[model samples]
Target: MAVYQALKTAGVDAVTIDTANGFRSKLKRDPVDLVFLALHGIGGEDGTIQKILNRFKIPYVGSGPQASSLAFDKVKAKQIFHRNGIPTPRYAVITTKNWKRILKNWQTPYVIKPVQEGSSIGIFFVEKKQNPAKKVEAALKKYDRLLVEEKIDGREFTVGILGSEALPVIELRPKRKFYDYQAKYTKGMTEYLVPAPIPEKLTKSLQIMALKAHRALGLRDLSRVDFRTDARNHPFVLEVNSIPGFTETSLLPKAAAEIGLDFSGLCLKLLSMAQNGSKEK
Candidate 1:
């Protein structure tokens, strides 16, 4: 609904198409000049909607089908991150078959989460010497696959990429243990510091690393690369949110506003990118 209002405010005649009813049926009434997808989670962000748009030769904002599919899978994204020399936390995949012997190389105070979920859903942070029996079982039952990753003790920062340029860093301080679903929403639960007070050198390095991660996954147009800087001040790529939240207060928009691009102007800029973007892969 926020993106819808932003598009209208930017002088674009945007249609509100709810996928719950159906995407094709919503567009059957009139021809769409462009498909500004704001769909989240599985059906939209996992390349399903992108493939549908490609079938009809419609250009849309955010990433293409391959990149969206890649970003939705944490394990695959991590593999690509490592392959491209991007720093990310160490992780091991777990299932019922190897649940008992999975901790051979893994230590306590680990972070366990669903392998393919977004919004930090099913994320568990175990403390020192704590047994994660219930957490492991719950994650496996829910996601079928879980990633037991080493927790990075550090400050959290996010780098937003608009077109080919990386925006300023935004630091996230969550009231909770980590930036979980509750901290992300439920206003005042989190504090965000834009142009995070790091040295210019570190800022430039993070921006370059963010662009590397973005291009490694073939993500284009717009995306945000989340990071965690350790006590050593080393930045590790957490994940890339393709088509991240777009409200005036969302991370992406906040970063854009730092450079004089207001909310409505940012909307128009993204729309212009889609207009000039290639419809055919």
Candidate 2:
């Protein structure tokens, strides 16, 4: 509702449509100028709604259908990164048919997650002492396919992309084993250091790498690229969030604030970008 109120305060007749129920009928009844998608997870962020909007010739405030789909699927996104010469962790696909082979070939100290999930849902880290076979079997029962990714031993950081510019890098310090779903949403579980105190050179490099990942995915207006730097400080592109959260306290808005862009201003900027079909500035 933050985005909704922001638009209302900006003197625009904004209406909120819950995509769960009869949003289509509502759109037909009260056609709005643009759609500020605040939806998350499967049906919302996985290009389903974007494809619908494209069919109806409605302009939305995020990437197109192709980019949304690519960003939603971890396996496909990693492939795109590899094609563009973007550095990502080594990974392999695990299925019911190939689970045994993966277990024998792949090592521990890796992450197992569903291909198309968000907010770190269903993510598990198998350490050196733990047995990955059980986790792999159980996960395959729930999810059709999973990704086994080599874990990067280093600090975690995220770079928010606004238009063509990369916002300040924010280092994430989680109080848990890794930044899981709870650590991400719980108020005090994680600490975020904006404009993370790093050398100017490394910061700029992260920002540039984030922009390249965004462009490679054909994303527009806004995005958030996650990163993991090794012990040697070599940054690897984890994944890109094509449509990240937009609340006042969300990471993207927080980064934008560093550059003197307030919450309302950020909302309006994205809206303006969609309305004018503006490319990266």
Per-model CA lDDT versus the true structure: 0.87, 0.90
TM-score of each: 0.97, 0.97
Positional deviation of residue 122's Cα in model 2 after best superposition, in angstroms: 0.5
Best by lDDT: 2
TM-score of candidate 2 versus the correct structure, residues matched by position: 0.97
Off by over 4 Å in 2: 278-281
Q: How close is candidate 1 to the true structure, as a TM-score?
A: 0.97
Residue 86's lDDT in candidate 2: 93
Tell me which residue pairs clash in candidate 1. none
Q: What tens-digit string does per-residue lDDT give for candidate 2 at 174-193? A: 99989998899999999999
Candidate 2 global CA lDDT score: 0.90
- Looking at model 1, residue 49 earns an lDDT score of 90
